[model samples]
Structures are given as C-alpha cells and as structure tokens.
Target chain A: MEQISPFKRLIASSLGKKYLMALTGFVLVGFVIAHMLGNIQIFLGPEAINTYASKLQNLPIAIKWGFRLFLLTAVAIHVWTAVLLTIENKQARPNNYADEKTVQASYASRTMPITGLIVLCFIIFHILHYTAQVIFDYKDLHYDLNGEHMHDVYSMMVLGFSHWWVSIFYIIAMGLLCMHLSHGISSMFQSMGWSNEKWRGVLKITAILIGAVLFIGFSSIPVAIMMGMIKPIIGH
Target chain B: MRLKLKVWRQKDQLDSGRLVDYQMDNISEDSSFLEMLDLLNESLVEKGDEPIAFDHDCREGICGMCSLTINGIPHGPEKLTTACQLHMRSFKNGETITIEPFRSKPFKITKDLIVDRSAFDKIIEAGGFISVRTGSAPDGNAIPISKSDSDYAMDAAACIGCAACVAACKNSSAMLFTSAKISQLNSLPQGKPEKDRRLLSMVSEMDRSGFGNCTNYGECHAVCPKGISVDFIANLNRDYAKASVKNLLKTIG
Candidate 1:
C-alpha cells in the first residue's frame, strides 16, 4: 500500500525475482557455452589451447576485467535473489507436508537448491584452482611459448588433472553442474515466457542436450588427462 | 465397505487442528466421498458428538465448493475429479483415509475440514472483470472468434476457482488459478483492450496475497478436477513479461 517506485516494485515481488533469475541465468549459460568451446581447444594440443588462452589474456585490461566484473555481478545478483525468493517461498508454506509425494517434479527440479549450492562451491573452487592459480603450485608450470610470454595453461591443466583426487573432484563437479543446467535451462525459458505446451517438450530436450554437451566438453579434458591421452608438455 | 477415517478436528481459527480417528462400517462403495463423510457425521450426531465441518454446495464436481486434501492428494485419489465426485470404491476395503483442509497461509482453517477460501475471491476482485456499461445482451455472433481461440479460452474458463492447485503445490503457489483467469479473459476480443493493465494488476495482486511462486511442478493440472493445464501459467508468464516492460516504459515516458 505504501508508495514505491516501479522498478523497486518490479524486482521486489516473487515474479520479479524469477525474471531476474531467468535473465542472469541466460547470461551464465552463454558464458558456459563459450567457455566450453574455448577450453575444448586443448584437444588440438598444448599450442592450440595456450594460443587461445593468450589471445584472451592479451585483450585490453579494461575490456577483460570489465567482462569478468560483469560476470561476477551477474553471479552475485543471481545467487542473492535466489536466496531471498527461496526464503519467501519457504515462509509461504510453514507446515511441511507430512506424507508428501512429488508426482510430477523431476529429480533435477526437486534438488535445484541443493545442486545450485554445490555448483556454487565448485565454481569458487574452480576459480581458485585455475584463475587464481593459488589452490595448487603452478609457478613452475608458467613459461613462454614461441618468444611470446604466456601462461602454460596446457601443463597446468595436465598437472591439475593427473592427481587422482583433483580429477575425481572435477568430474564430480561437472556432473553436478550438468544436473543444475538440465533444470535451469528449460526453467529459464519458462520464466521468460518463451515456452508453451507445444514447445515444452522441445525445451526440455534442448535443456538435456545443452547440459550433456557442457558436461562432456568440460570433463573430457580431466578424463583424458587421467587416461594419459593428454600429457604435460615437456618444455617451452 | 468398512473404513477407518482420520479426520482433522479444530475448535476455531486460532486453535491448531489434529486428526481424530473414527470407524465407519456399512459404507456403500457406490456412495461418493462426501456422502461417506455425511454418514460419519450422522453417526456422530446420534452419539451426541460434534460432527466434522466441511464446505459443499453442488454435490456435482462443477461447483468446486468442496475443498479437501484426501490422503495428501487434493480431490482424493482420483485424477480430474473433485472430492464430491470421488466415490468410496476408489479405496481398499479396509483402507484408512486421511482427510484435512486445504492448507495455505491465505486460507486459514475455520473448522475441521473447512478453510476460508475468500483469498480466491480477493484475487478475482483485483482485476478479473471488465468495466462495461450495462446494456442489452449483445449477440454472440457480433464478435467473430476463431474456433481455436474460443476453445482455448473456454478451457481456461473451466476452472472452478478450486484451490486444488494450491493444495497440490509443495509451495502452496496459486499460479495455476491466477493464470487461468488471466488466460481466459485476455484471449477474448472483449477482454483484449485492458490486457496489459489486467496482467500487471492481477499478477501484483497475486503476489500481495502471500501465495508461493510456481516452480512448474505440474501437479496443479494433474489434480485439477477440470484438467486445467499448467500451460496457462506459461501463457501468463509470457504476457506478464511483456506487460511489465510496457508498463515500466509507460511510467518513465
């Protein structure tokens, strides 16, 4: 009843938060696709992926960091709004159903919050493992390629995945990421009002395809490393 | 058929309810679920015990006045059937039935199995109508409508304002009901003029009612006596997104 701004009213409601989630989620999904494609270059050998990484790193600092900052902000908003909406949703049903049965919701849909939290943890660990290079010793792995000063991303990945525990963890994290995406993708379309009964089946199939692709593309690196298909480059 | 009933009993709105057990024998399987309840109430009255209170108007499923969560499923175990239409034969000979009121914050338990459903009325009052001058009835053929559009509109109009969707939802969301009304009106030529404003106001009003958000559980249509599809909710979400954008631009401009 109190006077409020239209924008404030827009994002303050449950429907508003869902719209926010859908928008930001679409951004994150795009980043995931691009990241997977870029990383899959490793299959061409150390030079291929390293060159791709260097090209990305060599961009203007403003452009590079600006994009990173934008992604980080998107992630923050997505997580924060999800938490608020979840709390409100919980408050809506104070008494839990004693003999509840999920008749139609998929396992992925039912476990979205849990999978989301797990994926968040994996993302933080992933950034620490690769981006910050602080989770493991990668100082010795950095070297120049072809007179161009570049980080040895291939060696770093090989070394990181060669360890059984890290490889297993990465694979597990990718699995959870796929599960998260399976539900999030179709749900994004639903929230955006881009889906209907006719296309609902198609949307779900598309979600599964995207999730599977990301899973296979990302995990292939670590799995291949563990299987000795990809090895650490001898030197610069 | 002999059955054991675990019916919820509450003194008043402030009091917490609990399920009390009662045995009923000689129940004919041909009798509807509500009729069985009526038989139980008759026996209770004979014993000078308080009878269970429930809401009912038409014994047929059309009215939707019956609101009960039978065995944790709204409208009993039968799909696309209201509690009034649910017969005793759906259960086993000695099966125990757990009957409770539709639980939601906005719908407070008024008594045993009856809860206040005026929250639905409040939602309808928000924007479920058109402002038109009173005049003689217009000919149905005055406005031409495609058969498909009319069918879609009628499908949505079949909703009986039952809160089964809310009860079946894990979060107690009312998206299905709200969307049905929005879809019904906005699809018609007569209701097209105020479509944008209607969507914005109705959705905001739904949010104001303290109902949970729809996560596409699909249970709403599964248990809907009228078989209202969750697709209407999707239709609503699409319209809402467009309306929100238009309204925001209008306000700023």
Candidate 2:
C-alpha cells in the first residue's frame, strides 16, 4: 500500500473523525426517524401496522436485499468509527484529572463507548429476534395482514414484547440508546458548524425531544405488550 | 477573606511544572481574580521572592489574552464571560482555586497560566481575511446579507480565540475556534468569493498546527466567554465540502 500522505493524515485526524461521525450519524438519524415513523403505525391498530409490515416484506427481492445491505454497512461503519475515535481520544489522555480533582465531563461523553457497546449488543439481539427468526422462533412469530405474510413482523414485534424478560432488557437497551443519541445528534450538528445561539436553543430542544420520543415510543411498545394491552399471536 | 490558591508554576516552556499552594488572608471579596493574583505577586515581591508570572491585557476579556484555567474550568465559572470579567464575589470566603494554563501542543506555556496561542494567529493568517482594495471603503448596504445570516455571522464573529475551547475539549481540539473564524467569514456575501479557499486553507492549517481533532464535545461552547456555538463548525464543514467540489470544478474548467 502506498504511504498515506499528510493530506490524507489530516483527513484521518481527530478533526477528520468529525467527518465520519457526521456522515454516519446523519445516516443513522435518518434510519431511526424512518424506523420510528413506521413504528408509530402500531398505534393505528393492527390493520395498519401489520399491513405496513407485510408491505415491507413484499418489496422486490433486489430492493429488499439492497436495503438490508445499506443498513448493514451503515451500522458497521457507524459503530466502527465510534470505537476507533473513542480509543484515539483515550490514548491521547493516558491519565487524567490529577491531584484527585473531581471535575468531570458529562456521563454521556465519558461513557460513549460503553453506551455504544451496549447498544451494539442490543442491535445484534434485536436483529436476531426480528430480522432473523431463529432466536425468537419460540414466539410463534408470524401474522398475515392485507393478504400477505410479512414474516409476521408485526406479531414478532408484539410477541417480543410479551416476554417480560426480553422486553425488560430491550427497555434497558433503548434507554441507553436515548442517552447516546441525545448528545450524539446535537454534538453532530455542532461539529459540522450549524450551531448558533438562536439555533443552539432549537437544536437542544430538538435533541431532548428526539431522545424522549424514541425512549418512550420504543419502551412503551414492549411495556404495553408485556402488560397485556396487545396479545401474542398464538399461531396461524 | 483568606483563600488558598494552588497554581501551576513553570519557569518556561521546557520546564516541568507542579501546583504550588499559597495562602493569602483578608483578600477583598470584590477583588477580581487577577487582582487577587496581583495581591499575591505584591506580597512575593516585597518578600524578595520570585513573582508568579501570567498573561493579561485590556484586563477586560475582549482581546482574549487573559488565558487561565481555574478550578479545572477555563476562565472560571461564569458563562459567556472571560477571566477578566470574573470577579472574586463568585468565590466563597474560604475556597481553594487551582489554576493552570491552557494545555495543548500548539499552545506552549511561557509561564504559569499563559500559553502561546500564536498557532491561532497562524491559522487566521492562512485564511481569515477578505481581500479588498485600500483605495476606498465599500458602501455598507451593497452586500445585502439576510438578517438571519448577519445575526449568525455576528454570533460566529463573537469568538475571541481565548483557547478555552481547546482547554475544555477532551481531545484539545481547536475545531471550534477554527470553525467560528471560518464561519464568520464564510457566512457573509462579502466573504463568499473566498469561502472555498478560506475553509480549505484554515482547516488544513488547524490540523498542521498539532491540535487534536474535535470529537463533537460541547465543553468548548460551554466555557466560551462569548458562547460561540458548535454549529459554526457544521457550516465550516459544509463550506469546505462545497469548496472542495468548487475547487475541483475550477481546476477542470
């Protein structure tokens, strides 16, 4: 491989880290917003949510695979970039706050990696349950809506919540995600330079709103299912 | 009231330093932080001791020359105000304030609480100007900048390059400072012609200056005397991206 030039070095630098963070962050934000919009369909009663799920499955095979591939790449790059940047930051400050100083950064900044790792595990587990059928094979995970079998994505979602232990863990994971994205999104805009006094107030409010909405929206589905508000598909 | 100060002391850039605790009694509550330090220096001078050295000018915070990290915070606790504006009333009658210089590779300390921020000057020289003829000044309304843009331009222009951002950053990144300067120019119509070149040059200079990369930490904004937002950093990136594409097209054309 040719030597990486100084120009390349600058682009790969700590400042360069912002480029990757901003790009992937924007991508994931797009995915989350879209995911939530779709998720809220569940609130429209079974017909809409299940039909939407079925429609998702009925997408052309090539398009379906394309979406999957794109999402996978985004997830990999997002997590990978974060892990590498966090390590670089850690190595830069080998020891810190000498003389027993109690001064500290916010919990989110300090534990970005840990929260990211937890969210990673949750993502893997989440995919296996919904995207992959084997893990939640025990949950009778299929339902037909609008004359199509969407791998019973809706039922799987509902059933995943019906299990008290699984839902509890999911609640914990989403809570961590809320903490991560809350700071992550606002920080992303700041790094990119869209931040100003007037907009700073708006961005902050938007960050908090996104975090609270996602936390409640994601957490409630499972909690509501576990509380018997939605029934598990027994079979057929 | 009397207070204890454990301040970082070093004779020069090459010297290793440590915090040395000094006690002073009956320090007036109304005394400015620097004034309190002056009292310590006065006592030391009278006792035939080496006076502690630091930096200050304008003593009003506008010049961004008074750089000090007090109690692990850049310019002490007040928001949107510099060390000069920070008065002694903010502190308790009996308190310990630890002071240090801004730590970053680009900012070499000449003495206690004073680091050379000439790297910022270098970056500014690299791109922070709009070329114009010296013969005559342009009419004020000729540019016609949108109100929103002008307002934000003022916000970005508010940055004083105090190095507080680097001090507060976990990575000691100067992105906030560089971006604010870039945005201040890049936002206005007058500054638009050089937008691409300015961003590319300044960002490149910032990296060349041995500053760490910004990790999107908001500490810099938190401690900034003028409250410059990180969004200017975003506009910087956008401009740079646009500039890169523009540069490429210009090269081809």
Candidate 3:
C-alpha cells in the first residue's frame, strides 16, 4: 500500500475539509466584527471616523499588505472549501425524501449555502463600492483634517448610501450576512470540537447575538445615512 | 383503523421506482409499524400480486435491521424509537403515509424499501475494534476507569448502527454513526492502545465511503432511534485533529 502524506490526507478527508472551513471561517468572523466596529465609527462624527480612516491608510505598507493578503487568503480558502463540501453534500443525497421534513435544524442552518453565496456577492460589491471607489467615483471626496488631506471615507459612505436602491441592497445583504453567521459561528465551534452538549445552547445564543450585533451595527450606517441622521461633512 | 400508504416500490437496483398507494382497512392501531406492513403484504399476496420487500428483524428494535423512512422521518415521528417499535396509533385514521427506503449515495436501493447499507460495515471494518489476545476473561476492575468515562462510554455504546442518522441528514453524512463507534471505543482504557490508529483509519474510511461531511445541521441526532448525541462527533473531531497532528509530527521527526 502506498503511504499518503499526512498533509495530503488532511485535505483529502471530509472531516479535514471541515477543519479548514472552520479555521478560515474563524478568521473571516473576526474580520467581520472588526470591520463592523470600524464602520460604526462614522456615528462618532466625521473627524473621528476620518481620523481612523487616515490612521489605517497611513499604516506601514508591509502591515497593510500583510493584513490584506491574509484576509484575501482566508476568504478564498473559506469559499473554495465550502464549494467542495456543498457539492459533496448534494451528491450524497441524490434522491431526497419526497415528503421532506426538518426537525431541529434552524432555518438559518438549513440555508447556509444560499446565505453564504449571497454574502460572497455582497463582499465583492462592497469592496468595489468602498475600497475600490470605482462604483460611483468617490475619488475626489478628499478632506483636510488638522491640516492633513485624506480620503473622505465619511462623505464617501454617506453619499454612497444616499441612494435608496444602494441602501436597500446594503441592508438586504446585511440581513443575509447575519443569517449566515447565526449558523456559521456555532458551526465553526462544533467543527473545531470546541462545543458539546453542555455548551451547545450557550454557543447557539452567542452566535445569534453576534450575528444580531453585526447586522444592527453594519445596517445602522446605511439606515442612518438614508435618514439624514449622519450627514456628510459640508463642502468636502 | 383505515389508512392510505404510499410506499416506494423499486423492483431492483437499476429500476426507476415509484410510490404505489395501498388502502388498508381495519388495521389495529396498537400493531407495530412492521406488523401493519405485514398485513399489507399478506393482502397483496392474497391478491396474487407481488408483496412489498422490506427488511425487519428483532421487531422489538434491537437488531437494527429495520430500515424505512416513514413520512420523510426515519423511524416515524416518535423520538428514540425505531420503525419496528413504532405503533400505528401514532398516525391518524385515513392518513396518507409515505414510506421510502433510507436514501444515500452509498446506500443503493436493492429492492422495494430495502437499501444496501454495507457501507457502514466497511467503516466498522476499518478500525471499529480492539486487538486483544485470546485468553481467559480478566477481572472487571483491573483497569480503574472513572465513573464519568465509563458512563460516557456506555452512552456512546448504545448506538445500534441503524443508519437512521445517515438517512435523516440532508447531507447523508455518517459523522454521527462514525463518531459514536469511535467514542465508544476511544473512551475506554482497553481501547487506548490503538486510539490514534483507530481514529485515523476509521475517519479515512468514512470519508472514502462517499458519505457527505457533517455541517452540524444536527438532524442526525434528532432522528436517531438510540438517542445518540452529536457530542460524540465533537469528540471525534478533537481526537482526529490530535491524531493527525501527532502523526504528521512523527513523520517529520
């Protein structure tokens, strides 16, 4: 018999794929929470948020590129592994029960693949709209704060979400992202063997709480902008 | 009680099966689900028609031979109960009950309501055992096992290999079944010798068996006739991770 390498075996096995998914998902979850926190800074006024944005922009090039590279890899691996697992799962049940029924699985748990795919699309569009600034030409929205000129991310976000359709799309995508995380959070714990009977209930509630917080936090920006509660800095 | 049953009837592995409706009259509500099937089979035989082919043994539910998806639920609506143990009283009069064989990629329908579940046996064959020397029975207290460990091991040992978990899972994953077997052995002192090897071999075999990966939807435990918990799967994940890392380190060393 041929001796397969342990690294190869880990990637080849179903359980191994789950470990990869869980690890990458953990990274992505951390990024999402941090990203939400950063986005909510806009509520603290333009100076606070613009200062935060400038700080991030002025970070050492190596650290910035390193973080971006890490995040990109995490997203890629998470998506690639999910696609493979979903294909395998679909093939496993070629013939489904005619009278299908769900017993204990949550609505969020059952619709993970759909929610995940939609969130992936949301991430792509989000990057294009905000980071790339190509969606709506926010390139000229520069602000001078403390005699330092910087990209006016605050006004960019405000103007970007001022469009009713854009806000609606953003809100809808956040809803799906929340749904995905509700299941994905606790599921990552189970996949990593960190959860069990005693902690299952607590973990589930925690997952829902995190998802709820992210939804409210991320959606609040768009909602506030649409309501004119958080206006862009005048004469930017 | 009168009832309507839409039973799946597949002549053979290659045949495209269909649901054949049977109107049964005067069925005893107290009768077991299998007994109701027997009554239906007898009527079909009397009519000079082919009877339904289903698997059942140890009607009390211990043998794990009975396999049927009663109305999309393996072992019917009752919790911690097998089809052989499910009484007809659970259903309403004139209710249209749909019955189908346990479906999965690895479990092909051999006939009507009969699927080949030998894939499970293959997983067991991989490492579901301990290599013990043939000798006289040793004293039970030779190995001092903690009360908690033994109790946990006993809980895992309750699995009857029914594959109801596999049938109930949308992914058709056998993680629950494979984990139960692993936990049952891995928890005991006697099974400690080949712990790493057992976890490695059995998990690899389970992956190769064409079963889907567990997504933690947890439908498996919900329909398990033995009330097996998904905690065993968590344990398996932990054990497999440790074993894989240890093996990899050893190879590098």
lDDT of 1 by residue, B1-253 (tens): 9899988899999887788999989999899999999999999999999989999999889998999889888898888899999999899999988888888888888998898989888888888987778799988799999999999999999999989999888778899999999999999998899898788788888888889887766778888999998789888888887887787887899
Best by DockQ: 3
lDDT per residue, candidate 1, A27-49, as tens digits? 99999999999989989998888
> List-wise, what DockQ does each model earn?
0.60, 0.24, 0.88
Model 3: runs farther than 4 Å from truth? none
The true-versus-predicted C-alpha distance at residue A13 of model 3, in Å, is: 0.8
Q: Candidate 2: lDDT over CA atoms?
A: 0.78
* Candidate 2, A1-236: lDDT as tens digits: 34444445435655556766777888887888788789877767677787887678789999999998987898887788787776665544343433322233567765677998999898898888777766768345555655655455566677667778888889899899888888787777776657766786687678878988998988878877777776755653
Query: Distance from true position, residue A37, model 3, in Å?
Result: 0.8
Q: Candidate 2, which segments miss by more than 4 Å at Cα?
A: A1-19, A37-51, A87-112, A134-150, A187-195, A234-236, B11-16, B45-49, B130-158, B184-193, B215-217, B227-231, B250-253
Q: How do the candidates rank by TM-score, highest first?
A: 3, 1, 2
Which scores better on DockQ, 1 or 2? 1
Query: What's the chain B TM-score of candidate 1?
Result: 0.98
**True contact recovery of candidate 1:** 0.46
- Top of the candidates by TM-score: 3
| Tens-digit per-residue lDDT, B1-253, candidate 3 | 9999999999999998999999999999999999999999999999999999999988988899999999999999999999999999999998999999999999999999999999999999999999998799989899899999999999999999989999999899999999999999999999999999999999988888899999999999999999999999999998899999999999999
